[model samples]
Target: MRKLTAGLFHSIDGVVEAPNLFQFDSFDDDLGALLTGVLGRVDTVLMGRVGYEQWAGYWPNAQVDDDFASFINGVPKHVASDTLTAPLAWQNAQLIEGELLAFVKKLKQAEGGEISAMGGISLVRQLLFAGLLDELTLMTHPVIAGTGRHLFEPGDPTTRLTLVDSQQTAKGNVVSTYARRD
Candidate 1:
């Protein structure tokens, strides 16, 4: 079964929105290696409509002779959007049909390496709450944003997660990996 993993860039105070507003230190080789390793494990990219639109508009034009650009542009992108349709403007992008939960469940059962979801907090919350996420990885920066949209919504049920691994990047970002406790 393919594992559904949520990889998010979060601020110190748990803000997952508008990552560009957060203070990002220099991306040294350590951070590069870390991101490369994370991207290497996933065969598919999952995202919501808004994130898909943003990424589709940007990544198609940002391609370079690099692993990230190549992987992002070349890999299959499954967008969970009720409004979007294909042929999607971005290469290899497809709109997910039927019920979202059912689609994700079927995707997990399919033969694949791993599925990764990034950004689009609403979709991430839905996947996490539906118990479809097998792993959650947060690359948390050191500075506090004080106010913004948080990763966990208010009134969410308590879900225990077991920490699988953690490492600090040279830029002081903490990369923490967690597995959902069944």
Candidate 2:
């Protein structure tokens, strides 16, 4: 089965949102290669309702390199939200309803490519609780968000995460890759 990797940029306080308020931890090209590597292997992206809204509002018109632009523009996005309607801003996007776990499990086992979730706190929590997350690729910034939406809430669940890879950049960014124990 393909892995479900959730790559997040967070503070020591576990805040994932509004990271732009903090100084970027990445130097000129320190972690660009790593991000590019992950994006290169992405076949599909799964996002929660909030993440979908944010991404739908931002990425479509961002002026960036053609490769990065194409990756976001062309990738298929599966958003788990019943409130959202069809005909979203991004191409090849859908709002999936019903048991999110079962749906994602089938998607992971399907005869296709890798699925990744970035900056989806609620979805991350759900997956974390279900132990559906295969790997967590985190880039921790030096700055901390004193207040914002935290990545971990009241779940208080125990999950296995084995560090398979890690690296730190001169820009005060530490990148780590963790695999699920199961």
Best by TM-score: 1
Cα-based RMSD of the predictions, in order?
A: 1.4, 1.8
Model 2 agreement with the true structure over 88-169: per-residue lDDT tens digits: 7688887776789998998899977778986488898788678888888778888767988877777576777799999887
Candidate 1 lDDT, 5-51, residue by residue in tens: 88888888999887778856644577679888878898998989999
TM-score for candidate 2, residues paired by index: 0.91
Model 2 per-residue lDDT at 15: 79
Full-model lDDT for every candidate: 0.85, 0.80
Residue 17's lDDT in candidate 1:
86
Residue clash pairs of candidate 2? none
